[model samples]
Target: MIGRTRLAVDIGGTFTDLVLSLPDRTLSTKLLTTHDAPDEAVIVGTRAILAEADIDGSALDLVIHGTTLATNALIERKGARTALITTAGFRDSLEIAYEHRFEQYDLYMERPAPLVERDLRLEVPERLAADGSVLLPLDEAALRRLADVLRAQRIEALAISFLHSYINPAHEQRARDLIAAAMPELAITLSSDVCREIREYERTSTTVANAYVLPLMSRYLGRMREGLAGIGVTCPLLLMMSSGGICTVETATRFPVRLVESGPAGGVILARRVAALGGYDRALSFDMGGTTAKITLIDDFMPQQSRHFEVARAYRFAKGSGIPVRVPVIDMVEIGAGGGSIGRVDPLRRIAVGPDSAGSDPGPACYGRGGTAATVTDADVVLGRIDPSRFAGGKIALHPALAHDAVLTDVGLKLAMTTDEAARGIVEIVDENMASAARVHAVENGKDTAGRTLIAFGGAAPLHAVRLAQKLGIGRVVIPVDAGVGSAHGFLDAPIAYEVARTFLVRLDGLDQALIDALFADMRAEAEPVVRLGVPTGELAETRTAFMRYRGQGHEIAVPLDNAALQPDTLRQAFETTYTQLFGRIIPRLEIEAVTWTLGLSEPHVLPRPDQVAAPAAAAVVIDTGRMVEAATGETVDAAIFARTALRSGATLLGPAAIVESGTTTIVPSGFAARVGYGGEIIIEEKMA
Candidate 1:
């Protein structure tokens, strides 16, 4: 008999991908993203996939979803009309972020405008010390007076972030109660609830961002649930979070800020799984969809994670050019180098690719949806890298002539070159862009890409994977099954999990084990309920980490803590080890202090290991051959084409070649060879000289 049936849905900038996993086989589909009603495409796609699988929606055991809606809201500034309430004299914290210019040399640099306008940033007379002691009592009368002003401004959401609320929630909680009583209809977000950390600006920014998107996310979640039920999918609907975990809809709705990187997080999860299955100790995950390409490094089958990341950068994709949110997130670098990224010639007569995209509505010029600009897709079609008839499984027909015209007009004529040369230049520039991003990201993490295998996925990644690998000095690339919808597949592999972070500063020598134990107990009390809502019967796994740094230092490093016991000496040793690993040395005389504590609770999951395959004695038969431009040389070459489904385990083929599938195509470049693994994944490796 078949076991549980699951469906995973991912909504990206240009496409909505769905994966339906059955006991015997898996089915997948892709649809253009419906910007106006994002859920409409999902509902329709769900019905179609279910019908194709010969199953009903009622047969689904679970449904997991991840979307870029929240991130888009912040990027486009299309969220609700929100107001902020802060302690007196700190109303400018959002504007006074870091108090230093992120780009010191660029005189024309601009900072991202705060989500809450200055006038909407109201203040009340209340104060709290660093130790959670009350310096001045709450002025309820002053807070009440702001209600009229908020009403006059027609505020849809409110954010309350008082000074030092991370240490004690009394004032923030009381303020929330009072506000709820007066303005029951307003959506309010509390800093203590969203981000309980030390930095004043980051905490306030996180709270305000949460408030800004609360109403919109709440309504969207409700509509999604209703829409799913309307199609007879009454199973539990879980949501993918930025931390590579799936949580119940209720938990996700309450903390929608955690969903900003949800879609890309799923891709990392899938990469981690692929790394483990392929027995790769180090890997680089490359996910290139329609609008952006996300690159992440994986060590020991774990993706690099962070407690803080900026969003919606306003100045040249600089670090401090966006709003900072303090939450658990997978660390990665996203660049605008996807299939639909626009290509243009600058005034200097140089080729430039994007941090912008022509999303599905107009898409690429080849899509024939009214777009006139040359995009990466247009370049690919013009270069013969993509088959116009087989694009998107024939759901959408592509116009090669339109692609050639767009490329010639936008880049060729400007550069005084032919259509093929301009297209190749566009592709080469975008690949170099991605390569530079990967190199920088790896160096920033104190790692190198020399020995790491590239795990390529998403709709556009496979077409450019080998070239990217060659640029990074990587010898191997693994294109897993269902690469086009890899992130959606990852949703099915995620564990039900939740994480809680708290700020508690103390010297290592003065750390109180009893107090720390109580603190952890409280944090567990906070996170367990959230995890249990999604998984009730499984044994929960726990992980602990402390953000430690030298006394009086401005930064910290994460040190893993043991779940068994807490000892001062052990803590010091762990901190020193982690600190030394990062900086190559640690100060011996300075005392270390713990600034933040994090507790993660997740349901345990056991992954089935892939079976090993032996070497093949025979070469795979060629299905067909097509002409394509070789990456190593600028000359056109005849490349063999094979059906992925027809290639069995241990089957091998030489390049240049294309392995075609319904959802995506894997391109094996001129100097590489391809092989089929036990799990039906295509492994491409460089040819020996």
Candidate 2:
């Protein structure tokens, strides 16, 4: 059967990528992201690619999209005027976040500012018991007055979180009803709806964050859909969630906070798929684009995931120094070390790279688009790693002299170094920065990074993967086909799904079977409409997980549970087994209780398994080439250059060579040799001693 025609769009900080899968082939492109409009770039690229493929946009049966607009809005503090309505005495929950400083030893450490200011955080008279019983009746008169204040203040969005509302959403739902009656135009998010788990601070933070970005996301998505429709493409539009799942545009408009890591999450999903196809059990995903780099660890062909993550960190590795958004997300470490990351000299005359980026407006100095400052991409050109004439598949030519001037003036002058030396420093430092991040992420998650194969993708990853692999002592690397537009491609393969979770504390000894059944049913009901929107005719797959731990523990671990009639004894055994795997021991004499239950509904993935086959052998030959400086030494030499498309399977190539492809280049250093795998993967291995 012919494949269905699909299109996937991923909007990054610096670029908007489009991937169109026609019945016969795949087409892709990258264009500068229109920060002001965001969808303008998508429309232009869509029209261009569709015309290039000699097809009309109306032929598309589906469209998938992922974007960083929500994440950027929160980090830049550009969200709408938002207010938080909480139980009367709990208005300070956001201010009293975590209590312990993430950087305990620092004398001047600061916490992330709350998205909603104290003045805007209003209080209403309401109380609920630990069991979700109404301790005090909700004061409707007080809520009406608060509604008036909110309207007078011109609040665009509102977040409502009442104490113990996770267990009983009655109070929160009533407040929402009252607020809607008064301000029907207001965008509101409830903690009970956004995050139905315990922990007031995290739940409130998540809800407030959702409300903060709701209006912006809703408007942007609406505009984007209209823009796409105007171009003759009329199909079901899906949004990629940070949890590596796809949902309808309606679901995305309601809970847009789940999209903070959606772009990177797509790359991880692509990596996992490639690894499974290549028969690799362990792989490290590295995605480097124009404005940021992301690294994730994949085990057993699944990307690691988490329910809690921090954003906009004030301190790079400090846990509590960033705003926490408790939503289901793939676990990864991201830093501003991409091609367009600006390089600067600190006050101490030391070289520093970003957390800031030039993005796509003017781009790098070499783009000849008016960017004056030096960036990582400019440095690569100066060092000869990038061929000026073939940058961006020859669509845009780079100016070598401009790269030299920018690096020399911005870095060489301050450090008393040559253009080559400064460029080398910038390049080496960023590689080290990415490597260091990968190491830390692995160590924190109790994972080993020593021998994992680096599955690299995106526009800039292949350019740096080799050096990064050497730094982390990795022995192999895989650069897949169409690596430049990998994330957008991954979006085409994502499952249309939604996860629903609720907090209902229950001990195993006295497990309430009836309550468990009802809870799961309700969650499934909530998720079904979202899932059916994308997979209307397919058999839905359901997954169940319970967050369990010792009663005294502050955090819980997720354990998979049978959705059918599960016995209490069997559930206890499963939880204990999982606890042992994570902690290596089970706490004796401790009562284990489940704090949160989750149910996920999605279209079942029927991906083909990789064929286990023997490795192939090859020969070394040189073709088109470029002169590049050795990263270890400043000496320039002839780096062997070979076209990735020309090399067939089982062909072996040596290091000190450049594997050239569209959108990216893999530098094979002297110590490594690449072997082509049967699955179209370029596997680089360390040469034998």
Candidate 3:
């Protein structure tokens, strides 16, 4: 069963990558993502890979997928028509946000617009005390009137979030039952079910986000299932979640908000696997696609995980300016600095690269796809960084002349510089943007990135890895085998897993062992069915967590919990131990509080152990024939181009070389040399003068 064929698909912003794994080998293919009909790209790429492998789709044991549709729908404002129902007098929570300025110095800073407009948000009379007790009874008549208004307005989806729902959930559940019974055809999302956190703004925003994407996700998954069935495939379709786990299509449709950032999560997973295999305890995973770039940190073979992320920021790098959604997400920083990001002259006459992208349909000017704007890809082509004839495994021919023309007209003419100078500026600016994001993320997590190796992947990462690494002061870089299709390949390596989170408050002064034990039991029972639906029988693993904080604090930190049943004394000791590890010292005589609890159950993972290999002795360096190329200093220098596939273990190729592969290109700047490691990972080291 372990050797059976498996299929993995990753739908990205600009391309769809498909990977087919047979018993003997693996094959991969890429196609331009069809935004108008996304399933068409999936079908075409899947069929191509299956045909290449010479196997029918029915023989596949499982099909796993990761997609950006949910994220894209929210960012582009293309989701279903949604209406919000909330507790009376709290309809303005989404608009008011936290009332703190993200940019303190700016006199005029605008907050992101709410997903649901004021007109679509209706209120009902209901109230619950903070201690899970009812204060004001729910107005059933008001709920019915809201339902009538929704029906009359033709609302496709609804979000219900009552005050204090996280504590009791009685009112929220009752409202949902009433709404569903009244309008059976409407898609509904309850705040308690989506997120049971304490913050009203975050909870309401998350529920609204879930409702907004619920209808679109349901229709898309239904179409994909039918499309696969028509092609004679009869396997269960699983979707990758932002939490770095896989769930069934049914779960995805029910909670589509979890799918946001799913595609980037796959890349982080791949980077972790590579780090473990290469025996690196810490590393940075850099993924640059056509429309965005992502950076994540990995420690001890696990990517950093967070329960908070935002979408569509009003300012590029500032936090708290975007719509916040509380979900389990692989913690990473994403920016719009991909290959197709447009370059233009700003009002200040300074050359600027983007938060705007050409995307797949119009693509970059060099793709001959009806785009006239200059982009990062166009800059690389015009600057002689990428070969005109070898992009996307030679499937697409890049027109260098068009790139030069676009740069000259749009950027160079206004800046009074040559085309090459403008191209260089664009590349440097984008690389700085990625580096700045990495630095900020590391500092926030109490990490120093200088000692970490950079693992580069995606369509655009290899093109910019050297310069980005130089900026970060990182001395080593690794380009894994099949780096271009890294995300799709990661899908084949994922484990069948599910995570469940709930809110239950407890003060440490009066610890109750029986209550805690019952909480864990209930969590396991709720998660078992969801995990079993995707995994085969008799293989599962469980992990528990507690969100702990000092009394009177508004935020909490996640602490790991032991699975063994414990007495009150033992639980108190464990809480102190975790608190000390996080904050250096426990607060003196301050009582600890447990805000919420989470339980995650997963299928047993079959991860490969790192193979022990003898260290290789230094060997004589080999130099391929060199070519003369223009350098950044406006001087011609001798550079070597080597075929990455032909480089053997311990082979050292020196400075100013281009390691060209079918899927990606790596440029080795002056004063650096690359060595092939044992696992086919290319490691670049700076040569001492």
Candidate 4:
């Protein structure tokens, strides 16, 4: 039997990464992203990679892909013209989000505008109670009248989210049928279908988000498939989801909202595997690409998961300042801090890194692609941290003079400092920004950063990994093989899976075995077909979880359940145990109630062994490279440079060293020591004083 040949592709804001895993070896490449037409880069890169490997696309058995297109559409408000259909009295639900200001003290605080305008937000006479009871009949005549309005408004997509539809989706379903019958070409989404849980605002937001991006994602997926077919590749193509799982392209098209964090989620999956392989119980995953940086916390080899997240924050990246979308996602904090992040002197003459990026079209000042703004990459180049001759493995040349001029003009002159000082300040500010974000994320998750191992990857992460680790009080850092295209590699490791969540409120003490059993049965039935599409002949793994809380509490915590039949006493004990873990104590005499149930089905995954290192060497050898500025201090230092391909297992190099690879470079700052682990990982730790 021949091992499978798989291909994985990850599309970031500024680059499209491809990884081809043959039976014996893996080939990888990185290309600048084509923002106007993302699939263009995918096709071009795919063809180039295949040609280099001397194989046709037909040699591939499977293809997996993850992209940031859907996320960018939501953040830039570039999706289709969408409308929302809701109950008569709830036309303004989106605009009236949370009914309170996310930034209370700021008088000029502005909430994100709803995707659907008030003029296009049509309503009908229909209502359902919280417990799936019908309060009012559907007004067919009114809905039929609204179809003409929709046509006149030229809406490209529609979102149907009737009141209380999470419990009873009859009204929403009927509305969709009627609208689809009238206009078969229009894309339609239902809150019940996308988010079958409580919280009216979140449900509607999710459905609207789905409808908003449906047309764009559908067309892109279809075109991508056709392109692959043109290259003689007819393999099954799976999409990475925000929840760190893979699903067929069909599911992704139907629920594009789930792909918002797909690209970043792959990095988290890779971190989990690394965590498990290295036996690191607590690890922090850091991914920094060209346009954004993402931080995820992992515990016990599992990245934290969430059912809700916001997009396009309008105020200081505060919670509740962006549009909320409810979906199963690997919880992470993302900020606009990347290689292309622009640097500027704020009003106080203090250096400020970004929440804005240059992206690929204009790139950074060093790319010499018509970009003049001072960016983090430009700073790195000015500081001599990146080799102008070796960036992107010599695919693209960097102009040091351009980097120096841009940084000098933008930051140096403004701050009355030398170009080198300004460059150092820029790198320092960006590093601090990422470190602060990681710290805040940890605190929010009831954890701290001191004792965790930092796993860094992506295009820019390895460049600043040691500095970031030091700032977080971390002593250990690991850079896995192929760290630059880490997310693409992660795509190859994802499992075929689907998850179903539904609202089923009931007190643990009043839990009826039959009712709970039926609920899970239905959820399992729904997820089975989705998972089977990818794995047709196997016993799928199953997991059950319930969202439980003390009665009258505003939020709930997830409690895992066994496969056996539900029992009130057993469920109560489980709930209490989970609650205590999260809160450090359980509420005495408080009744525990289950509000939501989730069922996940996936193909069992057997983790592969860590990357193989080269033959062990008798002793470490170091070669001094040219001088470069140490980021930790403002002084120049002589750094040893080693090609990653040349290093053998058990090799060690002292601080002020650079490990260069095809895709990225790992910089070991002063006071740090780098060792080649047995698993081909670059393990950097702080040396004892």
Candidate 5:
């Protein structure tokens, strides 16, 4: 059985969100992120939320944390001093990634520099054939000689990767032993341990990434645990993984690279849960916080999942432009379009929002912090989309004059327009930017987003969801309860789970059933301990998947298999069914090969079910507020405002209106109307002309 008192914290690039839930009620808060110590924000937010709930930290039964620290550390190159140990002649595999340029036409394209410099990428004289046969034994003397060199370099963490290590990790394990004996204090990450997959470059890069952030994550998690304990909270601290599952802190510390997408994963979870509650079959999740906006596609109440994802891409959405981390992740497209996204006039005198953010240290000009930069928040303030006095539940009073000045100086002056017009341009551009991204992502996944309901959450999503939906040609939007801290709330709904994936190349006809069984058993052995640590006493469920593709294909599509005894015919039929659905037709007469296998262990979640969920009614209230400028028409109109809590399940309110809450506000444009659902969720739909 789950505990009654639990807490969830999600630390993003700009804000730290916290939710403290008790039997009777739930309390949540959002604070600007403290970059110096992400845990500091969590502790402070936790304390504040508990105080509001009138409960001591010690009363909490569990603590769940999800953070973007790993992602930030990689993008900023702020991880510990690291080095790489690889097989001889393959030291440049990570550097010589993919061989060709990701942006081929650009002659001046610059590659993402490898984390480890050339000097630090030490090579051990060893060779292994494709079949994992030891061709040249590892030279112990030579490896020991490099010990002095590594010690002098003062490397805090080391990554060891060897050719054919996926098939046989003997050489990699030996190298790790030698290094540990020499530098016992070093944080070592082995490729076979982190990601035992094919693709030498990706494997090495994933290992290097794990090692790079190992020390930092270890320290941060330690401090978080201690900090909570000091504050009278003595509960197990679980972490949200990128795969939308909760894990023990030990598991997260071992593979912090998996936490790169942890924060966004929570948002996806929230969308999926809320989608299921509202009975939305096809929905798009738009999570817009202060630093970034994440778009995830959900079908039949399940968010899309992928085994591999890229991070820190130079070309924002370019697939191969970032470092690839082979970990279970919720598939989504993210963009630097958020409330704190900086807005500026480019050289061509065109207004542009980010790919870069102001964050919290110096937030938007309207935040009244040290920030003077014009940001999307400032534009929203200038356009009257955000109420100055009610921003952040009135925790931070906004200054409209400063916002107006920032917008006028940054955009209006550059383009010879008024502050309002410039703000309009910024909002329009950002909305279109998100819509374009959604369209691109949908096309890539063979999905059409036109008919999907937009489940908008996070601090900024509700403020922009209706407009974004309009831009996407979507007619409906849902903003769940406590939308501001949606991700943190999502953590409470997650289950104790872990996934283990490894490369085990085999053809269906030549597949060794015993080997496959052993492989899955080994994977279960690795994941069960982690899941058991989190769940302690629960029935754990196991799911198996094989990544299969036609012969000669570069990548494979995931095909689920029966957890019972596997056979060649069953595997082939499953692969063909999924392949046909994906491509409309399977390649005939081609041999099929399985490249990787993944085993997931999870405790069953007692999912919530909403009752009396229904569509928006055709009735609405005509409560009018002061005149506000119409987003599309440039002319001021009498916009209505409604208190969200005062409305019941069947109550409807038409736009142009602002549905106000303490921490979040949903803007329904004149072309739309909103109705309250049985789950207390606000559903907005377009109005017929």
Candidate 6:
């Protein structure tokens, strides 16, 4: 009975989506997000989905959730009042970030505002060497004095970051114990336990971010659990991770910092799976939601992973302009181009789309949500691309007149252009913004956009995929059935997984076997319980990796560890091989050292195999008798609007057509054709000349 039902939820800036899976059917619903109380949207959406599916909450086997709350909290500066406790001379480390300007050429470029001001950052005298050797012991009296200062200042949470804490952590641990003994109610985060990396600024910034959001995330998660239990849903809730894995609620609440990019990671997972289904090994995932558009590259069915990501960039596309968090995250580029992105005309009379959005409360002009600003969606409606009566599966009717009036008054009349021209300009500007982001991301990763097929998803992706693909010179596009709720659907395909990282400094010359074994064992032990919470007994697999580099290098690369017990020499050879593969050559004289080790456990599940699919009947051209419209060149073209549910496998249709489904809409341009594949995915392939 428990295996008969499952639930997945994804919370975005403008919408919260819920999906319920029964044995034979899936039901989904979308609701406006409640920013004031984030869990309220989850409760409402979950109830609606379960009711529509005719299932009781008690029968659910699993609940997977992803949300933007943590990311929003950091961006809006709405986290808890937090203080930092650090070694004496390092009090200014968080404030004084890497002393490099993000924009070297601009004379007036401003740096990102520090999260924690100087007054709140208290110092305790302690030091540790880079090799885990204790230099100056932590002073309990000094810690207590700092604790008193924090208490007097009414700090709600505290972060403990010490010099060389990733290597030793003894001083940070002792400081945490002392702080907890003194202040029982204050939440605490230790840098060594959270990140366990070597960069001082990045590690401390990550710890501070965790501490700042700890209280808020803890309270929200606790309330959500209680609410779900009150409704008789006794199943354990798991959360998606930024590293493209899933972990238990306890793990999420303990390390909420890792959830910052979780939602976008889900979209990447969907794109990768869709790519494999369509027989494309190299693909670009393009997701344009209500507040942002994320672009990620995938090869061999895996999204790229990175150990560093920045948020709230002062310069939109600059790398070093924001707070750096060193965690395992899927590598992607996020730009502020989305449905709710506001469009305006600059003083030079050039049209510009957003780095600012009219969020759910005051959505685009056509939503009737009290917004007066023109947005991308409003532009689409005015350009005759979106049907007002059929938007969002007819759930919300849009007003075209309001969109026209907003654009004409704000942008059109001033620029001496017609309303349609202004709307087209807005669409073109956003498309170029997204294209520029994709180009930059590919260049940074040593990839070429022309060689990768575009896998488009998210609420606004289908509306613009054709134009976007054309801009990038990409030859093919694949739009899945549930593109609007793609991230939520991706949750169903995720395996139950967890990753544990710990610092165990080992110089390759020394080769400490006993220490290496103990460190790996500790990491595995820490990761097992979290993995077991989602997976049943005796059905789990694990992967081991060590972060290694040359002796004096600034960064490290992840090397795979063999499942069999590692002999010292064998391990050294493995490291040498991995180093060469990553850097093209190994260091001739310097030794290789491992600074950190990670162990990941996952209960693997098989996705539906596409290669095993039986080909359907010979494709037949079906004429759509609904309506005719211009899709691309503004020339009248016969377009068919077909119901996606009625199209079976092998059903083919030519372009300029609109495929409408319950959750999303796909528009095929004039030069392409679509066919339903074996697994019910809509595959859009470009026609040859």
lDDT of each: 0.91, 0.88, 0.84, 0.90, 0.87, 0.83
Which model, 1 or 5, shows the larger TM-score? 1
Model 4 TM-score? Answer: 0.97
- Evaluated against the true structure, the overall lDDT of model 6 is 0.83
Itemize residue pairs with steric clashes in candidate 5: none
Predicted structure 4: lDDT: 0.90
Top model by TM-score, which number?
Answer: 1
lDDT of 3 by residue, 261-307 (tens): 88888888888888888877889999999999999989878888888
Return the TM-score for candidate 3, rounded to 2 decimals: 0.94
Model 6 CA lDDT for position 84: 94
lDDT of 6 by residue, 278-355 (tens): 778889999888899999988877787777899767787788998788887889999999999999998898998998
Clashing pairs in 6: none
Q: What are the per-residue Cα lDDT tens digits for candidate 2 across 521-604?
A: 999999998888777685788989999989988889888887667677888899998888666788888898998899988888
- Greater-lDDT candidate between 4 and 6: 4
TM-scores for candidates 1 onward, in order = 0.98, 0.95, 0.94, 0.97, 0.97, 0.93
Which stretch of 10 consecutive residues in model 6 shows the poorest summed lDDT? Answer: 622-631
Q: What is the Cα-based lDDT of residue 390 in candidate 4?
A: 76
Better of 4 and 6 by TM-score: 4
Clashes of each: 0, 0, 0, 0, 0, 0
* TM-score-based ranking: 1, 4, 5, 2, 3, 6
Off by over 4 Å in 5: 1-3, 613-624
Stretches of candidate 4 off by over 4 Å are 1-3, 608-615, 618-624
Q: What does candidate 4's lDDT look like per residue over 1-689, in tens digits?
A: 11488889999998999999998889999999999999999999999999989999999999999999998898889999999999999999888999888888999988888888898888999888888898899999999999999999899999999888988888888888999999999999999999999999999999999999999999999999999999989998999999999999999999999998999999999988887777788999999999999999998787898888998788746899888998999999998899999999999989998878999978998898999999999999888788877788889889999999999999999989999999999999999998999998888767889989999999999998888988999889999899999999889888888999999899877788898889999999999998888888868889898998889999988888989878888888899888776767888998889999999999997765545445475355564486789888899988888888778778888878888887888998888888888877888998888
**TM-score of decoy 5:** 0.97
